[model samples]
Target: MITYSSNQPNLYLVGFMGTGKSVVGRRVAEALGMVFLDSDRVIEEKEGRAIRDIFAQDGEAYFRDLECKFAQMGHPKRGCVVSCGGGMVVPDYVRDLLKERGVVVVLHASVDVILERVSEEGHRPLLEGEDRRERIEALLQSRQGAYADAGEVVRTDGLTVNEVVRRVIGIYRLNEPNFPL
Candidate 1:
Protein backbone atom coordinates (compact mmCIF):
# COMPACT_ATOMS: atom_id res chain seq x y z
CA MET A 1 0.00 0.00 0.00
CA ILE A 2 1.12 3.53 -0.73
CA THR A 3 1.83 5.54 2.40
CA TYR A 4 1.80 9.27 2.94
CA SER A 5 4.95 10.86 4.17
CA SER A 6 3.07 13.44 6.20
CA ASN A 7 0.58 10.92 7.57
CA GLN A 8 -2.09 13.61 7.40
CA PRO A 9 -3.27 13.36 3.84
CA ASN A 10 -6.41 15.28 3.03
CA LEU A 11 -9.72 13.44 2.81
CA TYR A 12 -11.57 14.29 -0.39
CA LEU A 13 -15.32 13.57 -0.51
CA VAL A 14 -16.63 13.44 -4.09
CA GLY A 15 -20.05 12.47 -5.30
CA PHE A 16 -23.24 13.59 -6.96
CA MET A 17 -25.11 16.51 -5.41
CA GLY A 18 -27.29 15.67 -2.39
CA THR A 19 -25.13 12.70 -1.57
CA GLY A 20 -23.90 14.33 1.62
CA LYS A 21 -20.32 15.33 0.74
CA SER A 22 -20.43 18.62 2.59
CA VAL A 23 -22.15 17.30 5.67
CA VAL A 24 -20.11 14.14 5.82
CA GLY A 25 -16.87 16.00 5.24
CA ARG A 26 -17.58 18.36 8.12
CA ARG A 27 -18.31 15.60 10.58
CA VAL A 28 -15.40 13.52 9.37
CA ALA A 29 -13.11 16.48 9.87
CA GLU A 30 -14.45 17.06 13.33
CA ALA A 31 -14.00 13.42 14.23
CA LEU A 32 -10.49 13.39 12.87
CA GLY A 33 -9.50 16.71 14.38
CA MET A 34 -8.86 18.20 10.95
CA VAL A 35 -9.95 21.36 9.22
CA PHE A 36 -12.93 21.15 6.87
CA LEU A 37 -13.43 22.97 3.60
CA ASP A 38 -16.06 22.76 0.93
CA SER A 39 -14.37 23.55 -2.35
CA ASP A 40 -17.39 25.29 -3.82
CA ARG A 41 -17.75 27.43 -0.71
CA VAL A 42 -14.12 28.43 -0.98
CA ILE A 43 -14.61 29.40 -4.61
CA GLU A 44 -17.73 31.35 -3.73
CA GLU A 45 -15.95 33.16 -0.92
CA LYS A 46 -13.05 34.02 -3.18
CA GLU A 47 -15.26 35.20 -6.02
CA GLY A 48 -17.67 37.00 -3.68
CA ARG A 49 -20.61 35.45 -5.49
CA ALA A 50 -22.69 32.32 -5.59
CA ILE A 51 -21.96 29.44 -7.95
CA ARG A 52 -25.16 30.11 -9.85
CA ASP A 53 -24.01 33.67 -10.46
CA ILE A 54 -20.62 32.46 -11.63
CA PHE A 55 -22.22 30.02 -14.05
CA ALA A 56 -24.60 32.68 -15.27
CA GLN A 57 -22.01 35.45 -15.67
CA ASP A 58 -18.93 33.52 -16.79
CA GLY A 59 -20.41 30.33 -18.25
CA GLU A 60 -19.60 26.74 -17.34
CA ALA A 61 -16.24 26.69 -19.08
CA TYR A 62 -15.02 29.48 -16.85
CA PHE A 63 -16.47 27.87 -13.75
CA ARG A 64 -14.84 24.57 -14.64
CA ASP A 65 -11.56 26.37 -15.12
CA LEU A 66 -12.01 27.64 -11.59
CA GLU A 67 -12.58 24.12 -10.34
CA CYS A 68 -9.43 22.97 -12.07
CA LYS A 69 -7.49 25.81 -10.53
CA PHE A 70 -8.75 24.90 -7.06
CA ALA A 71 -7.80 21.30 -7.64
CA GLN A 72 -4.34 22.39 -8.62
CA MET A 73 -3.47 24.61 -5.65
CA GLY A 74 -6.41 26.51 -4.18
CA HIS A 75 -6.46 24.75 -0.82
CA PRO A 76 -4.26 23.19 1.77
CA LYS A 77 -2.04 20.38 0.49
CA ARG A 78 -2.84 18.09 3.43
CA GLY A 79 -4.67 17.57 6.72
CA CYS A 80 -8.00 18.91 5.51
CA VAL A 81 -11.35 17.32 4.77
CA VAL A 82 -12.28 18.70 1.36
CA SER A 83 -15.80 18.24 0.10
CA CYS A 84 -15.27 18.48 -3.64
CA GLY A 85 -17.83 19.88 -6.02
CA GLY A 86 -19.82 17.03 -7.61
CA GLY A 87 -18.25 17.54 -10.98
CA MET A 88 -14.77 18.34 -9.77
CA VAL A 89 -13.37 14.94 -10.62
CA VAL A 90 -14.94 14.75 -14.06
CA PRO A 91 -11.75 16.13 -15.50
CA ASP A 92 -9.04 13.51 -15.67
CA TYR A 93 -6.42 15.98 -14.54
CA VAL A 94 -8.27 16.94 -11.38
CA ARG A 95 -9.11 13.31 -10.62
CA ASP A 96 -5.45 12.44 -10.82
CA LEU A 97 -4.54 15.37 -8.64
CA LEU A 98 -7.05 14.41 -5.95
CA LYS A 99 -5.82 10.84 -5.86
CA GLU A 100 -2.27 12.07 -5.56
CA ARG A 101 -3.13 14.61 -2.89
CA GLY A 102 -4.97 12.28 -0.51
CA VAL A 103 -7.51 9.55 0.11
CA VAL A 104 -10.65 9.95 -1.98
CA VAL A 105 -14.04 8.58 -0.92
CA VAL A 106 -16.90 8.81 -3.37
CA LEU A 107 -20.29 9.23 -1.70
CA HIS A 108 -23.38 7.86 -3.42
CA ALA A 109 -27.15 7.96 -3.06
CA SER A 110 -30.08 6.66 -5.04
CA VAL A 111 -31.67 8.87 -7.67
CA ASP A 112 -34.90 9.06 -5.73
CA VAL A 113 -33.01 10.06 -2.62
CA ILE A 114 -31.10 12.71 -4.53
CA LEU A 115 -34.27 14.09 -6.01
CA GLU A 116 -35.93 14.19 -2.63
CA ARG A 117 -32.98 15.80 -0.91
CA VAL A 118 -32.35 18.46 -3.56
CA SER A 119 -35.88 19.11 -4.75
CA GLU A 120 -36.33 22.27 -2.72
CA GLU A 121 -32.75 23.41 -2.84
CA GLY A 122 -32.36 26.45 -5.09
CA HIS A 123 -28.60 26.67 -5.13
CA ARG A 124 -28.06 23.85 -7.62
CA PRO A 125 -27.22 25.69 -10.81
CA LEU A 126 -27.24 22.72 -13.14
CA LEU A 127 -30.74 21.74 -12.22
CA GLU A 128 -32.16 25.12 -13.11
CA GLY A 129 -34.64 25.37 -16.00
CA GLU A 130 -34.82 21.61 -16.43
CA ASP A 131 -36.81 18.70 -15.05
CA ARG A 132 -35.00 18.04 -11.80
CA ARG A 133 -35.15 14.26 -12.04
CA GLU A 134 -33.95 14.20 -15.61
CA ARG A 135 -31.13 16.58 -14.90
CA ILE A 136 -30.02 14.59 -11.88
CA GLU A 137 -30.18 11.34 -13.82
CA ALA A 138 -28.22 12.65 -16.76
CA LEU A 139 -25.62 14.23 -14.54
CA LEU A 140 -25.25 11.15 -12.41
CA GLN A 141 -24.97 8.82 -15.40
CA SER A 142 -22.36 11.01 -17.07
CA ARG A 143 -20.29 11.27 -13.91
CA GLN A 144 -20.65 7.67 -12.77
CA GLY A 145 -17.53 6.47 -14.53
CA ALA A 146 -15.39 9.15 -12.99
CA TYR A 147 -16.82 8.57 -9.55
CA ALA A 148 -16.32 4.83 -9.85
CA ASP A 149 -12.66 5.28 -10.66
CA ALA A 150 -12.05 8.04 -8.13
CA GLY A 151 -11.51 5.89 -5.04
CA GLU A 152 -13.28 3.83 -2.41
CA VAL A 153 -17.06 4.12 -2.46
CA VAL A 154 -19.56 4.68 0.32
CA ARG A 155 -23.28 4.68 -0.26
CA THR A 156 -25.03 7.30 1.81
CA ASP A 157 -28.56 6.34 0.84
CA GLY A 158 -29.91 5.70 4.33
CA LEU A 159 -26.84 6.08 6.49
CA THR A 160 -26.77 8.82 9.07
CA VAL A 161 -24.11 11.53 8.79
CA ASN A 162 -22.19 10.10 11.72
CA GLU A 163 -22.23 6.61 10.23
CA VAL A 164 -20.94 7.85 6.91
CA VAL A 165 -18.24 9.77 8.72
CA ARG A 166 -17.12 6.63 10.50
CA ARG A 167 -16.89 4.66 7.26
CA VAL A 168 -14.88 7.44 5.62
CA ILE A 169 -12.57 7.60 8.60
CA GLY A 170 -12.08 3.86 8.48
CA ILE A 171 -11.02 4.19 4.87
CA TYR A 172 -8.75 7.07 5.79
CA ARG A 173 -7.13 5.16 8.60
CA LEU A 174 -6.65 2.15 6.39
CA ASN A 175 -4.49 4.35 4.21
CA GLU A 176 -3.00 6.71 6.79
CA PRO A 177 -2.51 4.89 10.04
CA ASN A 178 -1.03 7.88 11.79
CA PHE A 179 -3.88 10.27 11.07
CA PRO A 180 -5.46 11.62 14.27
CA LEU A 181 -8.71 10.13 15.51
Candidate 2:
Protein backbone atom coordinates (compact mmCIF):
# COMPACT_ATOMS: atom_id res chain seq x y z
CA MET A 1 0.00 0.00 0.00
CA ILE A 2 1.23 3.45 -0.88
CA THR A 3 0.32 6.79 0.63
CA TYR A 4 0.57 10.11 -1.21
CA SER A 5 1.87 13.42 0.18
CA SER A 6 0.01 16.63 0.92
CA ASN A 7 -0.34 18.45 -2.42
CA GLN A 8 -2.47 16.40 -4.77
CA PRO A 9 -1.60 17.43 -8.30
CA ASN A 10 -3.64 16.51 -11.35
CA LEU A 11 -2.85 13.24 -13.13
CA TYR A 12 -2.68 13.29 -16.92
CA LEU A 13 -2.81 10.02 -18.86
CA VAL A 14 -1.42 10.13 -22.39
CA GLY A 15 -1.10 7.27 -24.88
CA PHE A 16 -2.09 5.86 -28.20
CA MET A 17 -5.69 4.93 -28.73
CA GLY A 18 -6.95 1.72 -27.10
CA THR A 19 -4.26 1.94 -24.45
CA GLY A 20 -7.07 2.41 -21.89
CA LYS A 21 -6.39 5.98 -20.79
CA SER A 22 -10.05 6.80 -20.30
CA VAL A 23 -10.95 3.52 -18.65
CA VAL A 24 -7.94 3.41 -16.36
CA GLY A 25 -8.12 7.12 -15.66
CA ARG A 26 -11.62 6.76 -14.29
CA ARG A 27 -10.53 4.02 -11.94
CA VAL A 28 -7.46 5.92 -10.79
CA ALA A 29 -9.56 8.99 -10.12
CA GLU A 30 -11.97 6.86 -8.11
CA ALA A 31 -9.14 5.43 -6.09
CA LEU A 32 -7.73 8.86 -5.44
CA GLY A 33 -11.15 10.39 -4.79
CA MET A 34 -10.66 12.83 -7.66
CA VAL A 35 -12.64 13.83 -10.72
CA PHE A 36 -12.02 12.10 -14.04
CA LEU A 37 -12.07 14.11 -17.27
CA ASP A 38 -11.63 12.60 -20.69
CA SER A 39 -10.52 15.26 -23.16
CA ASP A 40 -12.21 13.58 -26.09
CA ARG A 41 -15.45 13.15 -24.21
CA VAL A 42 -15.41 16.74 -23.09
CA ILE A 43 -14.79 17.93 -26.62
CA GLU A 44 -17.52 15.74 -27.94
CA GLU A 45 -19.95 17.05 -25.37
CA LYS A 46 -19.05 20.64 -26.12
CA GLU A 47 -19.43 20.15 -29.86
CA GLY A 48 -22.61 18.09 -29.49
CA ARG A 49 -21.17 15.46 -31.79
CA ALA A 50 -18.78 12.57 -31.89
CA ILE A 51 -15.06 13.09 -32.40
CA ARG A 52 -15.15 11.18 -35.67
CA ASP A 53 -17.75 13.60 -36.94
CA ILE A 54 -15.70 16.48 -35.76
CA PHE A 55 -12.78 15.20 -37.78
CA ALA A 56 -14.87 14.58 -40.85
CA GLN A 57 -16.81 17.79 -40.68
CA ASP A 58 -13.96 20.05 -39.78
CA GLY A 59 -10.56 18.40 -40.13
CA GLU A 60 -7.83 16.85 -38.00
CA ALA A 61 -6.27 20.25 -37.48
CA TYR A 62 -9.54 21.67 -36.24
CA PHE A 63 -10.05 18.76 -33.92
CA ARG A 64 -6.51 19.12 -32.66
CA ASP A 65 -7.16 22.80 -32.03
CA LEU A 66 -10.09 21.77 -29.91
CA GLU A 67 -7.82 19.44 -28.03
CA CYS A 68 -5.36 22.23 -27.39
CA LYS A 69 -8.14 24.47 -26.22
CA PHE A 70 -9.34 21.80 -23.85
CA ALA A 71 -5.88 21.37 -22.46
CA GLN A 72 -5.69 25.08 -21.94
CA MET A 73 -9.04 25.67 -20.27
CA GLY A 74 -11.01 22.49 -19.60
CA HIS A 75 -9.51 21.55 -16.30
CA PRO A 76 -11.73 22.69 -13.48
CA LYS A 77 -9.57 21.88 -10.49
CA ARG A 78 -6.54 20.04 -9.20
CA GLY A 79 -6.55 16.43 -7.96
CA CYS A 80 -8.28 15.42 -11.20
CA VAL A 81 -7.38 12.65 -13.62
CA VAL A 82 -7.29 13.86 -17.22
CA SER A 83 -7.29 11.33 -20.05
CA CYS A 84 -5.95 13.08 -23.12
CA GLY A 85 -6.60 12.17 -26.72
CA GLY A 86 -4.02 9.98 -28.40
CA GLY A 87 -2.57 12.86 -30.39
CA MET A 88 -2.89 15.42 -27.65
CA VAL A 89 0.66 15.17 -26.48
CA VAL A 90 2.21 14.76 -29.90
CA PRO A 91 2.61 18.50 -30.19
CA ASP A 92 5.47 19.75 -28.07
CA TYR A 93 3.56 22.75 -26.74
CA VAL A 94 0.57 20.69 -25.66
CA ARG A 95 2.82 18.04 -24.16
CA ASP A 96 4.64 20.70 -22.20
CA LEU A 97 1.39 22.17 -21.00
CA LEU A 98 0.22 18.81 -19.69
CA LYS A 99 3.54 18.09 -18.06
CA GLU A 100 3.49 21.48 -16.40
CA ARG A 101 -0.02 20.84 -15.09
CA GLY A 102 0.73 17.53 -13.38
CA VAL A 103 2.34 14.14 -13.63
CA VAL A 104 1.86 12.99 -17.22
CA VAL A 105 1.91 9.21 -17.36
CA VAL A 106 2.31 7.67 -20.79
CA LEU A 107 0.37 4.44 -21.05
CA HIS A 108 1.77 2.14 -23.70
CA ALA A 109 0.92 -1.18 -25.30
CA SER A 110 2.41 -3.36 -28.00
CA VAL A 111 1.37 -2.66 -31.56
CA ASP A 112 -0.28 -6.06 -31.68
CA VAL A 113 -2.16 -5.36 -28.49
CA ILE A 114 -3.18 -1.92 -29.67
CA LEU A 115 -4.52 -3.34 -32.91
CA GLU A 116 -6.43 -6.07 -31.13
CA ARG A 117 -7.99 -3.66 -28.65
CA VAL A 118 -8.96 -1.01 -31.23
CA SER A 119 -10.01 -3.41 -34.00
CA GLU A 120 -13.70 -3.38 -33.22
CA GLU A 121 -13.84 0.39 -33.01
CA GLY A 122 -14.54 2.08 -36.34
CA HIS A 123 -14.75 5.55 -34.92
CA ARG A 124 -11.04 6.27 -35.15
CA PRO A 125 -10.68 8.74 -38.02
CA LEU A 126 -6.92 8.38 -38.28
CA LEU A 127 -7.12 4.60 -38.68
CA GLU A 128 -9.76 4.71 -41.37
CA GLY A 129 -7.70 3.57 -44.35
CA GLU A 130 -6.63 0.03 -45.04
CA ASP A 131 -3.63 -1.59 -43.31
CA ARG A 132 -4.49 -0.34 -39.86
CA ARG A 133 -1.69 -2.37 -38.39
CA GLU A 134 0.79 -0.50 -40.51
CA ARG A 135 -0.86 2.73 -39.59
CA ILE A 136 -0.71 1.91 -35.91
CA GLU A 137 2.92 0.95 -36.23
CA ALA A 138 3.80 4.12 -38.07
CA LEU A 139 1.93 6.38 -35.69
CA LEU A 140 3.43 4.67 -32.68
CA GLN A 141 6.87 4.98 -34.17
CA SER A 142 6.37 8.65 -34.90
CA ARG A 143 5.00 9.46 -31.48
CA GLN A 144 7.28 7.18 -29.48
CA GLY A 145 9.68 9.92 -28.55
CA ALA A 146 6.98 12.34 -27.60
CA TYR A 147 5.34 9.80 -25.36
CA ALA A 148 8.68 8.91 -23.85
CA ASP A 149 9.30 12.55 -23.07
CA ALA A 150 5.89 13.08 -21.51
CA GLY A 151 6.69 11.56 -18.13
CA GLU A 152 6.82 8.10 -16.58
CA VAL A 153 5.87 5.37 -19.03
CA VAL A 154 3.61 2.52 -17.97
CA ARG A 155 3.31 -0.49 -20.21
CA THR A 156 -0.22 -1.85 -20.18
CA ASP A 157 0.35 -4.87 -22.38
CA GLY A 158 -1.00 -8.05 -20.79
CA LEU A 159 -1.89 -6.16 -17.64
CA THR A 160 -5.33 -6.29 -16.12
CA VAL A 161 -7.22 -3.03 -15.62
CA ASN A 162 -6.78 -3.15 -11.88
CA GLU A 163 -3.11 -3.93 -12.31
CA VAL A 164 -2.60 -0.95 -14.58
CA VAL A 165 -4.45 1.29 -12.18
CA ARG A 166 -2.23 0.11 -9.37
CA ARG A 167 0.86 0.78 -11.44
CA VAL A 168 -0.29 4.33 -12.16
CA ILE A 169 -1.07 4.96 -8.52
CA GLY A 170 2.32 3.58 -7.57
CA ILE A 171 4.00 5.88 -10.07
CA TYR A 172 2.05 8.81 -8.74
CA ARG A 173 3.06 7.99 -5.20
CA LEU A 174 6.67 7.69 -6.19
CA ASN A 175 6.89 10.87 -8.27
CA GLU A 176 4.42 13.20 -6.58
CA PRO A 177 5.69 13.52 -3.05
CA ASN A 178 3.69 16.69 -2.44
CA PHE A 179 0.42 14.94 -3.32
CA PRO A 180 -1.25 13.30 -0.35
CA LEU A 181 -2.86 9.88 -0.47
Candidate 3:
Protein backbone atom coordinates (compact mmCIF):
# COMPACT_ATOMS: atom_id res chain seq x y z
CA MET A 1 0.00 0.00 0.00
CA ILE A 2 1.13 3.51 -0.71
CA THR A 3 1.82 5.45 2.45
CA TYR A 4 0.53 8.94 2.00
CA SER A 5 0.88 11.84 4.36
CA SER A 6 -2.12 13.11 6.30
CA ASN A 7 -2.99 15.16 3.23
CA GLN A 8 -2.72 12.35 0.69
CA PRO A 9 -5.43 10.46 -1.14
CA ASN A 10 -6.96 13.21 -3.26
CA LEU A 11 -9.15 11.09 -5.48
CA TYR A 12 -8.98 12.21 -9.07
CA LEU A 13 -11.66 10.78 -11.38
CA VAL A 14 -10.30 10.72 -14.92
CA GLY A 15 -11.51 9.18 -18.16
CA PHE A 16 -13.07 9.95 -21.53
CA MET A 17 -16.01 12.31 -21.92
CA GLY A 18 -19.36 11.19 -20.54
CA THR A 19 -17.73 8.77 -18.14
CA GLY A 20 -19.61 10.16 -15.12
CA LYS A 21 -16.48 11.44 -13.44
CA SER A 22 -18.09 14.57 -12.17
CA VAL A 23 -21.34 12.99 -11.10
CA VAL A 24 -19.69 10.03 -9.44
CA GLY A 25 -17.03 12.22 -7.95
CA ARG A 26 -19.55 14.43 -6.23
CA ARG A 27 -21.29 11.44 -4.74
CA VAL A 28 -18.08 9.79 -3.61
CA ALA A 29 -16.95 12.99 -2.01
CA GLU A 30 -20.20 13.32 -0.15
CA ALA A 31 -20.14 9.70 0.94
CA LEU A 32 -16.59 10.00 2.21
CA GLY A 33 -17.11 13.41 3.74
CA MET A 34 -14.59 15.07 1.46
CA VAL A 35 -14.70 18.10 -0.74
CA PHE A 36 -15.48 17.76 -4.45
CA LEU A 37 -13.84 19.79 -7.19
CA ASP A 38 -14.08 19.70 -10.94
CA SER A 39 -10.88 20.64 -12.72
CA ASP A 40 -12.69 22.10 -15.70
CA ARG A 41 -14.79 24.25 -13.41
CA VAL A 42 -11.68 25.49 -11.70
CA ILE A 43 -10.16 26.36 -15.06
CA GLU A 44 -13.32 28.08 -16.18
CA GLU A 45 -13.30 30.23 -13.07
CA LYS A 46 -9.62 31.15 -13.36
CA GLU A 47 -9.75 31.88 -17.09
CA GLY A 48 -12.87 34.01 -16.77
CA ARG A 49 -14.50 32.18 -19.70
CA ALA A 50 -16.29 28.99 -20.56
CA ILE A 51 -14.31 25.95 -21.67
CA ARG A 52 -15.64 26.24 -25.23
CA ASP A 53 -14.57 29.84 -25.34
CA ILE A 54 -11.14 28.95 -24.00
CA PHE A 55 -10.70 26.39 -26.75
CA ALA A 56 -12.00 28.79 -29.38
CA GLN A 57 -9.68 31.61 -28.35
CA ASP A 58 -6.55 29.72 -27.26
CA GLY A 59 -6.66 26.21 -28.71
CA GLU A 60 -6.41 22.82 -26.93
CA ALA A 61 -2.73 23.06 -26.17
CA TYR A 62 -3.30 26.22 -24.17
CA PHE A 63 -6.28 24.69 -22.44
CA ARG A 64 -4.23 21.62 -21.59
CA ASP A 65 -1.54 23.79 -20.09
CA LEU A 66 -4.13 25.43 -17.93
CA GLU A 67 -5.45 22.02 -16.91
CA CYS A 68 -2.01 20.88 -15.90
CA LYS A 69 -1.59 23.97 -13.76
CA PHE A 70 -4.97 23.46 -12.21
CA ALA A 71 -4.21 19.86 -11.37
CA GLN A 72 -0.91 20.82 -9.82
CA MET A 73 -2.34 23.68 -7.79
CA GLY A 74 -3.04 21.17 -4.96
CA HIS A 75 -6.43 21.44 -3.38
CA PRO A 76 -6.43 22.87 0.13
CA LYS A 77 -8.54 20.18 1.70
CA ARG A 78 -7.11 16.73 2.10
CA GLY A 79 -9.10 13.68 1.02
CA CYS A 80 -11.03 15.61 -1.61
CA VAL A 81 -12.36 14.12 -4.82
CA VAL A 82 -11.45 15.89 -8.06
CA SER A 83 -13.24 15.23 -11.33
CA CYS A 84 -10.62 15.79 -13.98
CA GLY A 85 -11.34 16.54 -17.63
CA GLY A 86 -11.30 13.73 -20.19
CA GLY A 87 -7.94 14.60 -21.74
CA MET A 88 -6.29 15.38 -18.43
CA VAL A 89 -4.72 11.96 -17.95
CA VAL A 90 -3.44 11.68 -21.53
CA PRO A 91 -0.45 13.75 -20.56
CA ASP A 92 2.19 11.71 -18.76
CA TYR A 93 3.27 14.65 -16.65
CA VAL A 94 -0.24 15.26 -15.49
CA ARG A 95 -0.71 11.62 -14.58
CA ASP A 96 2.58 11.53 -12.73
CA LEU A 97 1.72 14.71 -10.92
CA LEU A 98 -1.53 13.24 -9.69
CA LYS A 99 0.18 10.01 -8.71
CA GLU A 100 2.70 11.92 -6.65
CA ARG A 101 -0.01 13.84 -4.92
CA GLY A 102 -2.63 11.11 -4.41
CA VAL A 103 -4.61 8.29 -5.95
CA VAL A 104 -6.02 8.65 -9.48
CA VAL A 105 -8.92 6.52 -10.60
CA VAL A 106 -10.06 6.09 -14.21
CA LEU A 107 -13.80 5.76 -14.72
CA HIS A 108 -14.39 3.76 -17.91
CA ALA A 109 -17.52 3.24 -19.98
CA SER A 110 -18.26 1.63 -23.34
CA VAL A 111 -17.99 3.71 -26.49
CA ASP A 112 -21.68 3.43 -27.19
CA VAL A 113 -22.50 4.46 -23.64
CA ILE A 114 -20.07 7.37 -23.88
CA LEU A 115 -21.60 8.51 -27.13
CA GLU A 116 -25.08 8.27 -25.72
CA ARG A 117 -24.20 10.20 -22.57
CA VAL A 118 -22.37 12.92 -24.47
CA SER A 119 -24.90 13.25 -27.29
CA GLU A 120 -26.66 16.25 -25.82
CA GLU A 121 -23.52 17.90 -24.43
CA GLY A 122 -22.78 20.32 -27.24
CA HIS A 123 -20.24 22.23 -25.23
CA ARG A 124 -17.43 19.78 -25.94
CA PRO A 125 -15.41 21.53 -28.62
CA LEU A 126 -13.68 18.38 -29.80
CA LEU A 127 -16.98 16.69 -30.59
CA GLU A 128 -18.48 19.85 -32.12
CA GLY A 129 -18.04 19.85 -35.90
CA GLU A 130 -17.45 16.21 -36.76
CA ASP A 131 -19.33 12.95 -36.68
CA ARG A 132 -19.79 12.95 -32.91
CA ARG A 133 -20.00 9.22 -32.39
CA GLU A 134 -16.99 8.48 -34.56
CA ARG A 135 -15.07 11.29 -32.89
CA ILE A 136 -15.83 9.99 -29.41
CA GLU A 137 -14.96 6.46 -30.45
CA ALA A 138 -11.66 7.63 -31.86
CA LEU A 139 -10.93 9.58 -28.71
CA LEU A 140 -11.66 6.61 -26.47
CA GLN A 141 -9.42 4.41 -28.59
CA SER A 142 -6.64 6.95 -28.46
CA ARG A 143 -6.77 7.45 -24.70
CA GLN A 144 -7.34 3.83 -23.75
CA GLY A 145 -3.74 3.22 -22.73
CA ALA A 146 -3.44 6.29 -20.55
CA TYR A 147 -6.71 5.56 -18.85
CA ALA A 148 -5.66 2.00 -18.20
CA ASP A 149 -2.41 3.18 -16.68
CA ALA A 150 -4.20 5.21 -14.03
CA GLY A 151 -4.45 3.90 -10.47
CA GLU A 152 -7.48 1.74 -11.17
CA VAL A 153 -10.14 1.38 -13.89
CA VAL A 154 -13.79 1.27 -12.87
CA ARG A 155 -16.17 0.23 -15.67
CA THR A 156 -19.37 2.15 -15.09
CA ASP A 157 -21.47 1.25 -18.12
CA GLY A 158 -24.34 -0.62 -16.43
CA LEU A 159 -23.89 0.62 -12.91
CA THR A 160 -26.23 3.10 -11.32
CA VAL A 161 -24.85 6.35 -9.89
CA ASN A 162 -25.00 4.99 -6.34
CA GLU A 163 -23.33 1.78 -7.39
CA VAL A 164 -20.51 3.63 -9.05
CA VAL A 165 -20.02 5.83 -6.03
CA ARG A 166 -19.94 2.80 -3.79
CA ARG A 167 -17.41 1.16 -6.06
CA VAL A 168 -15.23 4.25 -5.84
CA ILE A 169 -15.46 4.32 -2.06
CA GLY A 170 -14.52 0.68 -1.94
CA ILE A 171 -11.63 1.22 -4.31
CA TYR A 172 -10.47 4.16 -2.25
CA ARG A 173 -10.45 2.12 0.91
CA LEU A 174 -8.73 -0.83 -0.74
CA ASN A 175 -6.13 1.16 -2.65
CA GLU A 176 -5.52 4.00 -0.26
CA PRO A 177 -5.95 2.94 3.32
CA ASN A 178 -3.74 5.67 4.61
CA PHE A 179 -6.18 8.41 3.76
CA PRO A 180 -9.15 6.64 5.36
CA LEU A 181 -11.85 7.07 2.70
The pairs that clash in candidate 3 are: none
Residue 176 accuracy (lDDT) in model 3: 74
Encode model 2's per-residue lDDT on 3-89: one tens digit a residue.
333247889999999999999999998888777899999999999999999999999999999999998887753678899999999
Q: Specify the poorest-scoring 10-residue window by lDDT in model 3.
A: 1-10
TM-score of each: 0.92, 0.92, 0.91
What does the lDDT read for residue 151 in candidate 1? Answer: 92
Best to worst by lDDT, what's the order? 1, 2, 3
| Distance from true location, Cα of 6 in model 2, Å | 11
Compared with the true structure, the alpha-carbon lDDT of candidate 1 equals 0.89
Model 3 regions more than 4 Å off: 1-8, 178-181
Query: Residue 39 of candidate 1: its Cα lDDT?
Result: 93
Candidate 2 TM-score, C-alpha based: 0.92
**Best by the lDDT measure:** 1
Which stretches of candidate 2 lie above 4 Å from their native place? 1-7, 178-181
Per-residue error (Å), model 3, residue 117: 0.9
Per-residue lDDT of candidate 3, residues 1-181 (tens digit) = 2243436478889998898999999888777777789999989998899999999999999999988888777355466789999998898988988876667888999878988888756678989889988898888889888888877989998999999988888888786765453
lDDT computed for candidate 3: 0.83
What overall lDDT, based on C-alpha atoms, would model 2 receive against the true structure? 0.88
lDDT of each: 0.89, 0.88, 0.83
